[model samples]
Target chain A: MSSFDRNDRPLVDVRHLKQYFNITVGPLRTKALKAVDDVSFSIRSGETLGLVGESGCGKTTVGRSILHLYQPTGGEVEFEGRLIKTKSDINELRKKATMVFQDPYSSLNPRMTVSDIIGEPLDIHKMYANKAERMERILELMDRVGLNSEHASRYAHEFSGGQRQRIGIARALALRPEFIVCDEPVSALDVSIQAQVINMFVELQEQMGLTYLFIAHDILVVRHISDRIAVMYLGKMVELADASVIYDQPLHPYTRSLMSAVPQPDPKVARANKRIVLSGDIPSPLNAPSGCPFRTRCPHAAPCCAEAMPEFKEVESGHFVACHRVNEL
Target chain B: MNKRFTMHIDVDAFLPATDEEKAYMVQMRPSSTFFRDGVKRLLKNKVATVSLIIILIITLSSLIIPAFWPYSYESMLGVRPGKSVDASFNNLSPFEYGETEQARIAAGETVFPHIFGTDSSGRDYFIRVIYGTRISLAVGFFASLIVLIIGMTIGSIAGYCGGKVDLIIMRFVDMIYSLPDMLMVILLATVLKQTLAPVLEGTSLARIGVNIISLFVVFGVLYWVSMSRLIRGQILSLREQEYVLAAKAAGAKGGWIIRKHLLPNCISVVVISTALQIPSAIFTESFLSFVGLGVNAPMPSLGSLASDALNGLSSYPYRMVIPAVVISLIVLSLNLFGDGLRDAFDPKLRT
Candidate 1:
């Protein structure tokens, strides 16, 4: 599975990434909460891989771990063919890979002016010749993100949510990164403004030849921008396929149920669509089930499902699923 | 591939008529820094503005008036070399003339009237009050500065470096908090006065008195706990903000992040806390001075003057009333100003 032809090298390759948070449940009792367990994926250059999951399914953790925002408890992240194993390697990777956080309100420093917030990365890297050059570059970035030069001196709180997200994007783009983990960048935005911000993201990618690990819970939003989509169940990846393939013909029962839940715009299609609501709450990661983490809630659970976890294996070209009943289906 | 969709519309109609109109489309408000904006809001608050003015007037008079005043705070008005003390000059009421001054007035020689009366020692009461205001204001400001420096340093360090460092510093803070503040202050002041008197002898600080030095020491030792705790709480919350993470992700070092991100975000809290601390420091200094542990004799603090007036309280009550009113006025103004600063500068209170 480590085969990458010279012509198709991935920008970021995360293999067997595990992030287990040791939470104190009681006095002197610590339990490991596996937030992202054995999650493996690769993002090709100039492409977007949408990571879709429920709120606690570790989609955000996957993005953060790849960026080394949260140190992974196990496994490796390779950036542009170099294995990131040390602090320096991670720091080097940060120059080329960045993140746009979910909440624009909380993500930006309220005291910082727009220019200072955006120019921070450049200042950190010492990328400019002088103050004049730095200001010019910041203004150029503001213009690229459709912000006026006059907005440069204004603080983050003075802007609307969409505008603040634009400031965040400008900050991310300051280093001229090749890859960015857009962690639900538009989730907190209004429906009317979400499309506009998403469109700007798409335009930025096109202009800069950037790759994105776009993590979002909204499947429809993910499908709109993602070339490939991966669905996670609990802390594990359940399905990986091309966006169109996953939407048109979902193989895993969980993926099928997820697709069925997206409300169709057409009244006839909406009336015809079936909703598959899973039973029982998502089990706590501390006390996860023995075999498959999702087995208890799976509709097609079998005796074999309780014995061992299903291997995430490729079923067809460019499509993968982890299910005990995949062959029978 | 060669097809050109030519849809002709009225493009000229939408164009601006003049360059000014074009510029108007993107006009922006002139930019201002946080400090300037805070000042703008503060100036709009009438009560705080008036209080600030009063404080300024008092401070300026204290600094400038003593230089040109007709009588010295420490000199007896009618005492001279080789002459018996002129008892009639002592305790002259406000706007009253002594025997010598009245004789000079009868001789058609102009005599300066005693303003706010002479003290029992025959020193000018007005000059003493002015000097007292100066000392109290100076102590309040300097003590607050010392507290700010100590508290901000310890708080940021402990908050940023959590776990063992935080625990140790916090326990130390708790120990300080549990101690009886006033009793400790009084004890420290008394002990420090005895020790500092010899060390400060013949130095300029000796003129300010050993008691004032001990009062400052007491403040330095006891008054910084609240400030440190407040700053520590602020830094704890601010260090977790995503901007701090973003700064870290951008390769900022710990000190750099603390300086550029953490401290600035909680600057409103710092300003408000420092402002509020001043009045408490002033009140504490006055209270200590009232108990005879403030500035040395011959240097009247407002509290010491009130203490002295207690001897003649039945006969001349205004002496006590005057200094008490001044102390209340100064503390009340500072507190109201601090409230206004919180209202104006605090981001949490902003719309």
Candidate 2:
């Protein structure tokens, strides 16, 4: 984990962010699916904030809301100490930030050549002055992502998944973006390719001094790249800390169960690590438990746990947990 | 830890690959695009190839034969401005000469033989049929193109701007769907033909006549609903593609995304649907002409020609048969070609 100075101002600050999607339960009856509920976090400059959670845990929502791909239902998103309120501000934020999507097969325009795909951002932002400049920028970007100039004329379907992902990454770097929201960018790739992509991401970060809001369900990948990690349950952030601290000492019950569930690579350690298999299925977000989203599955759940949500407070320097039973457990 | 074996390579064996060897190792493929790939697949399909050839032959003859063929579509050979009627020219059988021409042949004067002979009006039947083929093909192609442009534009706009825009456009399409197709086309044709006649009186548009113009209007108004609905469905599914999202995230505008991302992805569906639309347009024009709502008097259309042939049914069945065969050939070949196109271009059906 790379350490950041305590006084370094956060590059992107999200204040009590919330994203709610209203769905009709029946004819004329609507209810809110709180996809991300009042979750707040910040990524310091050049930091990798790996967001790890279960499938429907609003991790991707958190990433998208920061970039305003999905407008937050409530809250403020401040980037580089400026509040993103007006249209021009959002446009500015877009220029400095971009996204790397999951599903490389569907993330690329099949009809366009690889050069056009990588040059799309430059075209959109009007960053280049002339055709030559644009072509130069596109070629430089393609080279940076390890693509041959000869391959630029081919379409997305002609390439393999890892190569297609490289195209996506090259596109993300098109605008010389300072931050990228990589939403499960490598989860759809083969196991061998994942390492190559993750290492490339680390290399890109170091070279370009770029920041990433890395969202994934795969813990090992997150642990490999993340400077700090945030864990979510249902729609709320359960724990946040340095990557090493969260792995060694996961205080929240949900976090503890999540850590215990990761299979150890060594046989002896795997046998020694006890799995805390929680009882019951994951409750639908629409009908989530009233207080403490994890209370329904928490082993130490008291009647008081169902009354109100616990506060996410700092229990130690740079370690935050949202559990009432943090002291005893 | 002690190594049991020392791993080493000879300095002499570490030579870099030669340029030719490197080139062989890379093994690059020649660049190709989706359109080129589709065409390659199309050429490989036997039935499609034959259908395309038939269409080419028919369409070319229709376009070319009218240039040099003797006799006009409207000229009655038996009735001259200042001469007595030559009744033998009327209703002559195929390759048969008129009476005057027969007399000339008896005097050792060569007389041209009538290829398909004359109709009841003593006009050249072969030239009329050729002109009718040209008109029918024109109406079919132009009408289908009109439908395609209007349908594709509205459909993409509605599909890309979902929620209220989609709801309103879809409901309008449903309303159009509910209207009886035949009744609407007939009513529109009648009304438009009457109105366009006067408007076309002093203009260059009068050459094609009011009926054909109204037929195009009818097709534009009525036939595009189905095409639009098809395009809308295609774009609805395609707009959700992640490429569109990536474009949006990069701050590309809606129009840009639609042009660069959405439309190109669904191009195969657009092409196949447009090809299928042509046959129906041709059929609609024929049916309209059959109902006497097609080309005006003296402007031959296949349907009107067939209707005229109905009077001499027993005597000149070949008249009706010729246009009918031509229409059938065009529609069938076009449909087969469309199927071949679907098989060739559709990524889902690539195997």
Candidate 3:
């Protein structure tokens, strides 16, 4: 365990992380699915870093890999200056970094009461001395997640989708974690309740001084909540930058196209903005594009874009982009 | 993120409720028919309910009634053989003393007492058959309980901890299952009786204890193979549930995980298996006894009584009919009861 300086140290620091799954597709044959390949990012203490990409783009894989939920095939993950290398290290890492799942209804056990679910981490980590303190902590978590204290005695299936997600949140918060992985946390929620849950997340972040890697496909949600944003294609990250710069002054052609697609609230502006529609389905990660993954669909693609993989570099302060034709664009 | 967006989201609200309460309310919700209708279908099964009641009553009677009746079939009534006796004295004896009374009467004719008739030894077949119910039911029940324990423990372990252990255990179960049921039960019971008979010969209680222990050993070992197979299939599937993964992530050990999650989830199937096993065990024990491989003479079991009736089938067919009917009824009731319980406990059927 490393000392908590609280001022300079980032809550989580990941470097060149790679996680590949060996899938057996035939007799005595195996193939690697590059689920999370050469990914690098960091979440500062008390800041939210949103990860945005389409389905199957390995956004969720990155979050899971960082948490050591799936063992990384390569690279290093350092939490508060301490490197995670073994099972015990990962177990200890879980105390500071926990995850909330995508499907709220399925994430929680149907058999467990709300209190037990919330107190599970506490029990595992031995966070409380007695039953009374455990009960008190459970009630406090329920209240923090906007659940009434009386609801602790009931099972998860009895609640609505939103309530179940709240219980999931309470569970993630049980260990008093410094960082959390919100894996499409509101994707299974109602559109109306999504705002409430999102607001609650922001409030918790402020109150607890927590850091987060909020993963989702919704650009508007990501832009609103994240201090910085990272975009991915296939299994590789293509862009990383401040949320406003990535949204407003996006340099990567993929980022530009994504931003153009989101409908602005002002109808006049929305009507005026050109929709840059990209063609063709995403290439499978098993046989990804040779160079820039977006080149095949890039409107401004050039011959050099197909020769070699582009290096991810910062063209402006705090704004990173990977493209062979960035100079031309 | 969009604080001003007010899209009317029809939320599916979950209130924390007990399982029973959740089930009832879910039934009342009426959006889906499967959950509520499944429960209704199970409740409508009449034969299953009746069989359950019959079994409960029979079990209670077998346990309770034996304490009050201390009269063994071998006990003599102290009346002179071929001598005319009072009707009351004839009533007290288990067998017919009527031959002497009739002879005296034809010397001056009179009726005598002979309820359910008699064997050549003047032992009461009626009282003996009644007493035999306890032995038959006991063999069925305790043997079935042993089978259930062995089956569930072996099955859950094999299924949950699949690999070399599962392969070895399942092969052993298969080896036992490959033998013919009747032949194997007879062989095992014969071996047990041979070993225990000398030590158990002196007292009635010892004789009864030997019979029970032999029945339990033979049937318990034989029947567990099928039950173990059933529970193994159930646990193999149940261990994959997300709740199991959740428990593991929560740091629960393998034993606690199996005890709290795996066993409770597989209970309905195990229960049905046990119920069905009871009747089959009784039938096997009865068949062994009928073939002269079960408990020996002076201790009447249903099979032994039926065997007696078989020799005098032409003159007194009632002897065979009575015991056979009881055996059939018990097996039928057990099947009905098991089927009913399976339907009721099935989660898919709950409407």
Candidate 4:
């Protein structure tokens, strides 16, 4: 496992991942909820890929699916170029990948001490040799995540919201994994706390050479931290490109609108930019449009857009856009 | 605010100590969180505390006192069967002897050493009542344990694993829930008495074992379905928690996940539910015994004593009142204790 190539490659690679939940409507009737429909992306080693989308756009689903939290309906997950197949393979992959959940208040076990919470992953992995080593590791993790070492003995509910989130981060970092799926880790935190946590994530990634799938609804925050950004709308990845290009050029109309929606601190630039309010609510995944899931809400939809779902193709250097009218646009 | 009032409010609102001071506060955790809450709730429930005290006294006296009855319960004392408590039973002096057959008996009927009085058989009613506590407490303790183990194991497995396992386990639990609990206990007890009793005649311990095991099984299996349902509901909610998912993401296996994450979260529910169910289990056992299906003859459980009292209701009302009061007191205390525990452990109800 150690000899596996680590020079310069994607730390985690997910290709065409799909997660569908079957909902029972009546005695015999059933409906497929395509929570994640053929979503694909990759995170290079030491790079942060921010996944920005609305609540139902399958952002969290993508993170969970990538970690095999929800067994994918169909897809391939490659970790460090090794293909994951069986449960054992997934288990092996999980050792190198972990998720920081959206809700800081609930992510940590309320009954557990900070030591136990952070020590859990190590205990599971059997990373430490003895009790003293385990405690030392836990305290080290606490210090790494900006938590005081003395806080290890205290239960999660005893801590403030910010402290809890830090404890959550410490738990995620316990295994010292190369890649982490941060699913809205700071969204439930206070504004001041969110910055501190986000900065801590950046610092840790640099220090540990970690890759991250940073999922959030806040585009500005994502753009600030991400090397590349992926915009998802209703289970479809509309655009994927460098953070600057995604914000400045934003090839897909949906991406452009989302970028425009971010409130610019400069009042003049903010007022001048037209807010592209999506015409209607996001379509339920059950009855998503036949072609191009986003066509129902895209302001620039055409007849071809309804003909069939467009291929997710690289339209320019490293910029992938999945829309029928990409050529026309 | 006055000092006392401020202290009162502070006591209720006291937060768990911070990590910086946990070393100094370690011993105080249980006292502050569990004992403080338990004592406060117990103090609020006056009836439960009174019954608890009575049970404590009964248990202490029964365990420490001598076995011999100072005066027999079945023997006719000076008091005739229907005589008033203030008159024939209490009127005769302990030192006096009867002159004639009728007056001798009447004078002999004096209270004497018969604190609980005599039953129709003339055995000390008080002594039998004290002895009955051992059986009642045993049934309560063991039967509740069996039910808890079955419920926790089945419920946690069903809930944490979910899908078909949950459906099958829960449906079976529902089926059990539909049956009359007492009816099941009787049917099971009857089958055990007929089939196993004869086989166990060779050994004394075996006989006791068969009796107790059958009794425990009868009540345990009958009552566990509700506990299972409770644990499953708790686990269902607990399984969705982030710690469980985090545990999974950490490569923790399913068994380890259940043991470490799911079980700890639901333990409070199981414990409080178990405490509440003990009295029911004991009551169920007693009811079966009273109806001639329970602990058998010579052992003398509260239910069997009450059974005898029921037979001589008109002749010796004391026979019924003593055991009946003891049984009710034990059940009431257990219920109050369960309530106190529930209030202490249940976060939703806690301030």
| Reference interface contacts recovered per candidate | 0.56, 0.81, 0.19, 0.77
Locate the minimum summed-lDDT window of 10 residues in model 4 chain B: B90-99
Model 2 spans > 4 angstroms off: A1-7, A266-272, B1-33, B78-85, B99-112, B349-351
RMSD per model, one decimal: 5.4, 3.6, 7.8, 8.7
Docking class of 1: acceptable
Candidate 3 — which residues are off by over 4 angstroms? Answer: A1-8, A123-130, A291-296, A300-308, A314-317, B1-44, B70-132, B157-229, B292-301
Candidate 1: where are CA atoms >4 Å away? A1-6, A265-275, B1-47, B81-86, B98-100, B197-208, B344-351
Q: Lowest lDDT 10-mer window, candidate 2 chain B? A: B25-34
Q: Estimated TM-score per prediction?
A: 0.89, 0.92, 0.80, 0.86
In angstroms, the error of model 4 at B342 is 3.1
CAPRI class assigned to model 4: acceptable
**Cα displacement (Å) at residue B90, model 1:** 2.7
Encode model 3's per-residue lDDT on A60-131: one tens digit a residue.
889878887678999999998889998888788878788888888767765567898888778777999999
Interface RMSD values for the candidates, listed in order? Answer: 1.8, 1.1, 4.8, 2.9
The superposed Cα distance between candidate 1 and the true structure at residue B10, in angstroms, equals: 16
Model 2: iRMSD?
1.1
